[model samples]
Target: MNTIDEFNIDVRALNVLLAVLDTGSVSAAAVRLGVSQSAVSHTLDRLRQSLGDPLFVKSGRGITPTRYTLQAGPHVRQLVGELRSLSVGPPFSPDEAELTFTVAANDYQRDLLLPPLMASLRETAPGIRLQVMPSGIPNPEMLRKDVCDLVISPHPPAVGDVMQRRLLDDHMTVFYDADQREAPESLADYLQSRHIGILFATGERMALEASLSTQGLSRDVAVTVSNFSGLPAFLKSTDLLATAPYRMKDHLLKGFQRAPLPFELKPFTLLMLWHQRNHEDPAHRWLRQQLIDVAQGLES
Candidate 1:
């Protein structure tokens, strides 16, 4: 097999190709790389000339990577990752760092955490860019395929090489418009009422729902929305109920009245999961610490 030496490209050129492949467009790659679109195209031209492969071709509305590009993409990603780990120079400084970090989280966590996180980054690390993606149940393939830098979810991918840490703990509680109806008084009452619940595209059941199922119980979900943000719309001014994390009172599901579940269920921990490759990376460490601080601030 041919190594990167055969391509006659430098690390910068490899990064250009990688950014293009990772983002699926020259324009988006430019944004990720903090450069102009034309500059990214020029680098791709250089890569094509050096490697004798078109690398990418125009697809319907966007672009699609060529077979050569797809085959070599993983190797290029690994090489760039290896090159980035070399800390032979000066100490790390967040203000001076210019790179993109991808985070996978659903709307609940996204709305709760990203706003404060972005404000902190804008002030302390002006050059850092956060690219957030939805994390549905957080499967191992997300980390294995280099999908994102970190995952914020209750269900961490059960992989040996993945590192996870508890960020915060919260339990589900019933949410409803008090103007419409009183809170359910028992498990039977909770099941009898119409529910407006979250239904992610991944079809992974929420931990609360899954646990209830284990006890031979389930909600009569009359309406379903993609994320927690959509719950407020259907729940307002109606006799509908929702069960979401208790912290949501300060986040997305504000103004809506909440009550504890009439039955017993253990609380779940929100966790931050990352691949083993990032265990010792300084920038990654700083990002994780910032998240820890943000989570701590929420409770105080």
Candidate 2:
């Protein structure tokens, strides 16, 4: 077996390994690394030869990590994270820095966060352009791969290695057309009304359903969509009501009327998450601070 120093593994190869481990397949790793599948395979071969072990092998359909990989994965991840931290230097100067940051958030967050955030950036960091990517929920592995610079979600994932900061507390509200006659005033009335729910491909829609069931009532789901932005449009044409965060109601559906949720639901925290690898990056720190400031201003 080669010593850690004698191994002389290329940083690029280590990066490839980390990507594959996080994504669970060579093809996926290739996409994340912005390289061809052949390149990822070649790097895997080199890593296997150097390590004298099959790091990953094809299982029934997908690749599974071998014993060696399972043991070495954490160390490799930590090493790569440390290296990335070392590569990032001082805080970026807003006026001089040329950067495009990608942020992952849902439509509700976009409504509440983007307008003010853009205004602040225009006044302070005019050179920085932000790209908002629609994200369903927090995924730590994706954050580590730098798929998004930050994730703004209602709840943080249970992963310990990721760093999270609470931006705001979100409470539920029911929205309906302002001119609607049969506005729901009680849980029973709400259950009788046609409801529209915004659900992603992978989301916790069942949780809301289950919560309603506990109250001995169920919503008649008239429509299911992926985002809250479209709900107001749907409500405008019909009496169908939708449930969403209170913070979004004012921004997305200005003319729509909202009422408190009939059944009690716990308030959820909106958190900003990033990989531990970026925890110390000066530019990342500045961005995180700006986000906090924006959220605080909105809440105030």
Which pairs clash (backbone N, Cα, C closer than 3 Å) in model 1?
A: none
Q: Which stretches of candidate 2 lie over 4 Å from their true place?
A: 1-87
Write down the RMSD of all candidates, one decimal each. 9.2, 4.6
Q: For residues 7-69, could you state the per-residue lDDT of candidate 2 as single tens digits?
A: 758779998988788778899889877899999999999898889898999999999989898
Off by over 4 Å in 1: 1-88
Would you list the C-alpha lDDT of every candidate in the order shown?
Answer: 0.85, 0.82
Total clashing pairs for each candidate: 0, 0
Candidate 1 is scored at a TM of 0.69
lDDT of 1 by residue, 37-142 (tens): 9999999988888888899999998999999999988888777677877853566699999989999998888988888999999999999999999988787658
* Candidate 2 residue 287 C-alpha distance from true site, Å: 0.8
Judging by TM-score against the true structure, name the best candidate.
2
> TM-score for every candidate vs. truth?
0.69, 0.71
